[model samples]
Target: MYIVRFLRCLVLLLVGLATVTHARAADEDLERVAITRALTDYIDGSAHARPEQLRRAFHPDARLLLSRPGTAYWPVSVDEYVGWFSGAKAGQPTGRIGNVLSIDVEADTATVKAEILVPSQGARFIDLFLLRKLDAQWKIVAKTATREPSRRSADRVLFVLSSAKFHGASRLPAGVSFGEVVEAWDAFRAAGLTVDFVSPEGNAAPINVTEAGEFRSRFYDADLMYALEHTHAPSQIDPARYRAVYFVGGSNAIYGVPENSRLQDIARHVYERNGGVVSAVCHGTAGLVNLKLSDGSYLIGGKRVSGYPEEFERQDAAYFKEFPFLIRKTVESRGGTFLTSARDQGYVVVDGRLVTGQNYLSAKQVAQAVVAILRKPADQQPKQAAEKG
Candidate 1:
């Protein structure tokens, strides 16, 4: 009887501990959100010349410490900073862009690092801010900034994956192609690009890796594995932060990805709104079939696209039977010209901002194509007409 009582007490203790842990985690997340909002207000306010937002983000007594070429120290008050935008129209662009680089919070205090770009003047500045939680709201208490030559854009690429682990209703296992992921990842990273993973269900994506080698082993590291294990949901993604969206291919790609409306919206925002690239490899092209632009026209319309065509699949196989639609057929039906090369050969089609690969063999090439486009001079890059959706 005593043992039974002890076990019950242990279970209750564990449950209580778990509840406490979850509560603390929730509190931390809320704090982070509040802190981020404060930082965004500061960035957007400066870029748009909004005095009100700047006032909201900073404490009245906040001071900015800066330096001039001849002066050793320059101290500006919050009122002085807000007054600089006194006559400017709110929400008007000031030819300045800012991005939050990092944030660290401890107890009621926080620190933030942000990058501000004045492209018109070819200047970049790193701003460090100290913040405090006051009256349950985060406010900037102090700031320091330094200028440097403009460098690369802080934009990153988002890799979309499937959460489906099984082929349709059958028990046949399906997962993302580890080879395709590794190849494209290698190419992008080599070009100094950051990649983030997202899925429809926001869970760890299953992977299928048939062969392994030293090249593959180098990429299959703890950081990459952790990222794969904790992919963000579509709702959690900020399309403005991504310069491109690459749909990864596998048998699992044909299941949940193409039909997800949120994912499609994210891709559309990245392509049309941000003038970014949309790419796919092998079955990943399946996700592009349903992507439509702001004018209600299909994005792939009249463009050449390549993917894992139906001809290559064994039509009689159980996995093929579970496929909702064939890639080539859907592409054609959506007004896209489906193209391919000989079986197993690397093939890539670059039609403006859309880049598609025929198979896993072409994954690296597809990434290189995107990198080439992105690396182009601002004046030479393709311009996408912005439209409301």
Candidate 2:
């Protein structure tokens, strides 16, 4: 009677162990399927800009937390976050590509790490998702995000636009080149530099709307368009706030840029302190002609530079006759060793902190040069080629 009772008890214990093992395996399989579904929904919603997909993927109470450099936390609710895709055009690369890096599960809670790239806006984001099992379903409850720098992480650039709409002498409608500004703006943005627009007059700068080429037109999104219309004036800018300052070129630049005392002081402050790079392209070099350092020496004197060639001026006799001064001649007279390449081709010269581009075609190259200079340590920075006497 005792042996029979013991055997019965052992049989019951083995049955209970098997039941527990099966239940645990089933739970793990369910978790895997639910996690994958949530991730798929997120990718489709973001890449396609479909609010419905996003709505399904995220919990009603989910919040997106963004960490900005040296700034306070910015939180966005699900509805507010979906609003960003309201204007997205179908099939356009909105820079919303996402890749799952890893996913971890712990009982009722899970965490996922993902990378999102927004090429249009020149941004890459690292996102962390927190999820919980509610009503036997997994939904993203919160997300924390940080941006990964695409280039030199800490660089900030200032793009100086000409506020003059027409040259007083030439009577031509000239302000800033739409192509020049947008090209360099996009390049600098892609390289992860924070760019601010400023002008000599602190008013809306004119752009040659018709001058936007294929590249410029492709990138002229709402944000770029808005920034051009709301540029700040020189008086409104603080020199110390930027790591580089680029003078955008146009015929009107000849009217107010070189002679503006305030602009000169700002450039001097940036260059003298060795705090940043100073650059100009095309006719914008006119601005550099009279810039004197704090030591009372001309900024471009004995420095290598380039700008709009004399040939371009000669190409149009009527236009040339009405100009204030030839760009190349002014630069040379200022003791700058002017350099050039084939006309209309991009030619950029980097002389330490001073950079110059030959024409509108070179605008992008000049901006890139500024970024390169800012990336290096002060002690390891390349020295300017031997200056001319």
Candidate 3:
């Protein structure tokens, strides 16, 4: 009788152990599914602040990997990543990003692998995301990437667009003036910098809303308007977080950007403390004339800069009536040396804290100049090269 009872007790203990083991396996499987779902939602549903989905699946450090395929990688920050989420929610998706081929998750981290084939150029690209979990939550924390087409430089830049309206002319598509600013932006995006847009105020700084009916009647880029209307906020822009600030010009810039003291402060911080390029053109140049530097002197005081020339302003005789004076004269009087084109090319200048360009014609050259300066290694560009080359 004693032996039989002991055997029964042993059988029960074994059964209990098996049950616990099976349950553990099930939990891990569920966690994996949760991870995949969250990442998908982040990729898909993030537009509307799908907080519940984001909270459950991504750890606070969640990030996205965007880059050229097969190149050494760098990823954007969380806030920057989320800006896309908002934009995505507000607009139709442009496959600027390639397909997300896979998501690999481990005990505390994960990685996302993606491949891109762009329309502007048939460039092949690959990117990877590395994520980690804290407090039982998984989040994307890092990104590593590569691109098939080799670049002139290994570094990438993040260009900030402050425009709320697109630059499409009547005969052109919206944001047509994308020019070099947009082109560099596209290049950097293809190379995998999470370039994004945020307005001076949290709202979409109205486009040429009140301007020429023929010129201003249309909406901005549907894609960009989606991004702006969604993530448009001043708080998201922290100058300390970026390497440089690229301000593009729009006629609306005359009225939209000048009044923001905080935006001016961010511009100053990016220049003085972080040492990033602050490039502006046309009406976009107005922001600089008022930015006060650390030494209490205005930033353009002694810098050689350029923007819409006074003559060019006169050329647009009917359009520039609101501006009090010509950029060249105003800057020169303020102790800044102004630059201009030979009337054919876009004119630009780089002097210490300021980088300025002439009219719309000079936009591309100006962007290239800004990128060249920032790409240098720790201010070591053979002084002569920087000054004369």
For each candidate, give its TM-score against the true structure: 0.66, 0.61, 0.53
Sorted on TM-score, best first, the list reads 1, 2, 3
Q: Between the candidate structures 1 and 3, which one is better when assessed by TM-score? A: 1
Which 10 residues in a row give candidate 2 its minimum summed lDDT?
A: 86-95
State the displacement of the C-alpha of residue 389, model 2, in Å, after optimal TM-score superposition. Answer: 24
Candidate 1's displacement at residue 258, Å, is 1.8
lDDT of the candidates, in the order given: 0.85, 0.77, 0.56
What are the per-residue Cα lDDT tens digits for candidate 2 across 1-389? 89999999989989999999889866765685688689778876878877777778888999888766676688888988877765646334455666565566789999888767665666678888999888888899999988864433435688877788776655667767776787798789777776778887764688776676665555437556556765767887778867888888876777777788988888888887747899998888888998998778788888888888677776555655666777778888878888887784788888888988888888888887877778798986769652211
Please list the residue runs of candidate 3 whose C-alpha ends up more than 4 Å from where it truly belongs after superposition.
Answer: 1-55, 58-177, 190-192, 203-231, 315-318, 381-389
List runs of model 1 lying over 4 Å from the truth.
1-20, 70-75, 87-92, 153-244, 248-255, 266-277, 292-303, 308-347, 358-364, 371-389
**Model 1 CA lDDT for position 110:** 93
CA error at residue 283 for candidate 1, angstroms:
4.7
Candidate 1 global CA lDDT score: 0.85
Of 2 and 3, the candidate ahead on lDDT is 2
- Report each candidate's C-alpha RMSD, comma-separated, in the order given: 6.7, 24.8, 20.4
